[model samples]
Target: MRTTGGQLFMLVVINAALLAVGAMISGGTYLSPFNLQSMAGQLPEIGFLAIGVMLAMCAGNGGIDLSGIALANLSGVASAIIVGSFLSSTDNETAFSIAFIAVALLTGLIGGTFNGLLISRLNITPILCTLGTQMLFTGIAVVLSDGRAVAVGSPELLSQIGNGLFLGVPISFLIFVSAAGLIAALLKFTPFGLWLMLMGTNPKAATFAGFPKARVLIATYATSGLLAGLAGVIIAARNVNVKWDYGTSYLLIAILIAVMAGVRPEGGYGRVICVVMATIALQLMSSLLNFGGLSNFVRDFAWGALLLTFLAVGRYNLVGLLTPNKSRKLV
Candidate 1:
């Protein structure tokens, strides 16, 4: 019986502990402004993907967006190729950057709509459908880029969006926060949010209540894809290029963040704020690992372990195991 507030509180405590430990171990480097900025700059790509995963999970029926990173890569690659055809990133940096972002988002929307059609119209399983599309998206990206990274050529506006800071916070981080806030408001105040939650909680009841299941499902995944597209824009800006294999471990990390945020895989429960906090926590942990000079392999192992641990905790109600049960004597 973990309430959202309780979970959020727990995350706050954990984040504080991680920060303190990292600072102590890194001899203050971990708490330095430069290090904090670096972490902020890197957070949005995975944060957006985690948000997409949260949305899909909230839609229930084993909902997940496994194709998120693939879609993101595809978005970037497709945008690079399409935008490069007409506008040069170096000469038309402003217009080129804007067009690149627009195209990336559009690509993501189309890919997501395709996924929604497969799951809702064709009655495909979410996991399998997404897995298949993941491969499809990756294949398309590879073909588009010819198995090479497509350079975005240092557009000033894109660079500013990806790497610049406003009021001592990374612009990308601010964008992520703003997007998360909007989604939070959507879940709180909209009929679609209510429908999504109800549908996940009890599909039969939702159907009886005249909920539009197929439409909701399609919308849910479409929104997820859009987020993935945004992630693509951020990725291209940060790395200055797009490739089919970028962020190979991001899918696992995104899933890990959602689960750590207490987003139930069975759906019907999630909070954008919680997901945000979870993203920061993971970022802190990653920064701490970097300070410790741990290898990427070790970090991956830790992520896998944490994912499994959280899944088990969710499945088995591990907290209840530690609480003593009181028995009443029969009169």
Candidate 2:
């Protein structure tokens, strides 16, 4: 069985249980369509970051991208500056919108590539490397924006991507689902996927087997950066402003989502589907807290506690506790 199967099941069960509890506490308003839509709409931004974290963790060598939310902020800020400059001419709305998305994606790719080069070539520790880049990205964003939020004037297309609904579903959520599906296919049906897992499982053995370790590492991180960039676009669209400090708790939340999804910190294993499930579950839990009239402080504390708990369990491979005793013996 997949390593994430147990966690995924647990998340589903927990999500249902939380919804039941929330409904009881809120006179059934918690299960209303409006609240559900709000919760679904909020999942994509952090979902993208969680996927990026999963990529880094799957790459091994104590790999992690601490700079994901920072790069996302930078991407949005850069895109907003460029697009806002051209908005005076309404005739170029299409061009400006396209340029906006392109800029965000480019920023993400470039930031990711920089991290990849340093880690893959300079042999820098992934944690320290990303930690430095995180500050650098935030610093650059602050400098560019003068330490203020850049207001985003909504272009119709960008607005649609961010807030439009289709068949009772959010467009942003659809984009996230499509991105997740593509990533899952990449990991399941590609040679690069095999090489990545092998490299993460044992870098030395992969090197002996003639894997292009540097190239793989660069590509892995580059993909992660692109995801962050896309997340920036979605965030700017939804919030109508791009601020360096938006979603200040996102960094920790993304890591928590990835860990809860059962992504191995030691590398070589993660499931995109599991990450998606975990994202929804966490969002539901957060929504539940909101329904209970809990403060943001309480939410943050809860998230911290959950992150620590999952980290300890994963570190010890205690996830097996979620499996059935009979299944364990068979395995």
Candidate 3:
């Protein structure tokens, strides 16, 4: 249930080495602790996507939302429109923020609920269900944006929250941490959480075990959508605009992070924290690559190599990396 120390140490060392390499490649600017903080900022949003997809995956060996990126984009558009529809230009930031959260949460729930029905009740395959939803969500986003961008204006506080630093940590990083903390708590402490893992590793066994399989399926998806929507809001808050294609690239990147984080694509074996760490590592790598003068192709190549290495390491090596004090024995 908890990560061990040696694995933790290995992860630290690996990330430290990567950080050093990234900083060295960037020369001076990327070496700063502040730069590290900036890179950390990128992890959370991507982390959200990874975790959201991971939850659905927990119920089956291969459950995932390939359209998660589309969900993220759709949420962003939804948030922008919500603000546009309800929020005021005057100055009451509190009301606007509340409205934004409510809209974001509800919209995400609806999307997730739909996907859950397709998979859980209708018995559609996860891959097919998500693919269909991905297109549907993306279309919804396009329609919301009128095939253009939804720009945020006069939301000064939003830019502050998105870009501001809280005690040297970016606000976006804080949001992710807060969100992750909550999710971790629920998964660790709730019956629903345990059921998810059970369902994933052996759905038939779980059914035989008499777990409320359908409820679990539906709940996981709904949670995923809610989180994805929140990520959208965060992105919108950061960029000060909701771009039609903002989160489109994140779908594959998220899946990559999930795999590297040691979450078994086969389901029922992963940790929220691992995904967060992998995401941080990935983002730092990305930032360093950008500053280090590597071409996008080279960066992508390195990412692929890293992913393969991570996969080869598998869950046990990664767990050993993240939690060394516990079982040295690989799963």
Candidate 2 accuracy as lDDT:
0.89
Local accuracy of candidate 1 as per-residue lDDT tens digits, 1-331: 2455656776898899999999899889889999999998899999999999999998888999999999999999999999999999999889999999999999999999999999999989999999999999999999989999999978999999989999999999999999999999998899999999888877789889999899999998998999999999999999877899999999999999999998988888899999999999999999899999999999999999999997886566553344324222112
- TM-score of candidate 3 to 2 decimals: 0.89
Residue range 246-325, candidate 3, lDDT tens digits? 85558878888877766777888677776677777788778867776779889767867877877777644655555555
Q: What shift in Å separates residue 214 of candidate 2 from its native position after superposition?
A: 0.8
Model 1: lDDT of residue 152? 91
- Evaluate model 1: give its lDDT: 0.91
lDDT of 2 by residue, 186-217 (tens): 99899888888888889899999999999989
- The regions of model 1 sitting more than 4 angstroms off are 316-331
Candidate 1 minimal-lDDT segment of 10 residues = 322-331
After superposition of all CA atoms, the RMSD between model 1 and the true structure is: 3.4
Question: Among all windows of ten consecutive residues in candidate 2, which has the lowest summed lDDT?
Answer: 322-331
